[model samples]
Target: MPRVPKIIPISDLRQDASGVIKRVSASREPLFITQRGRAAAVMVSMKEYEQTQHELEILRLLARGERDIEASVGFNLEAVLADADALLAEQQ
Candidate 1:
């Protein structure tokens, strides 16, 4: 079962932004901010945000690879792997 995200009113966020931010970081879950009883914005911890961005970047790379394949663009698998390994090593 999926856990429901924490929801708060904009006023509550305005009143205690730090507290709300702490809750998000501790739970590692998104906090949904509502305005006038409607959904407004969402917030997540820096850790979660970074992880999401990394995953998104991987998805973008996969999409680009697919595009390249459809366009008949040639690429060497070994060279790509070597470049990927170098990039991963740099991250480490």
Candidate 2:
């Protein structure tokens, strides 16, 4: 299971932004920011944020590939280029 992050209110963030920032930077886990009793935003170190974004992009690409496979829509690079060349020759 994924670990739950520590939640902080926006007010606390405003009052001691520097300290909160320091805490987040020093910790491995991300911090959750709440506003009006609802989840508003997330706070993570730059390295962690970049890593998470990269992982999400990879997941998205994997999902798209899986969908294409399930729908029987795939690629044959060599065959495609050969067909393209033949078409071009015919046109010429």
Candidate with best TM-score: 1
Per-residue accuracy of model 2 over 13-83 as CA lDDT, tens digit each: 99999999899989957899999989899999888888999999999999999999999998888999999
* Lowest lDDT block of 10, candidate 1: 2-11
For model 2, what is the C-alpha lDDT against the true structure? Answer: 0.92
Clashing pairs for predicted structure model 2, backbone only:
none
Tens digits of per-residue lDDT, candidate 1, 1-92, equal 98877899999999998998898999999989999999999999999999999999999999998999999996889999999999999999
lDDT of candidate 2 at residue 45, scale 0 to 100: 85
Q: Please report how far candidate 2 places residue 5 from its true position, in Å.
A: 3.0
TM-score, every prediction? 0.79, 0.66
Runs off by more than 4 Å, candidate 1: 78-92
* Residue 74, candidate 2: C-alpha displacement in angstroms: 1.8
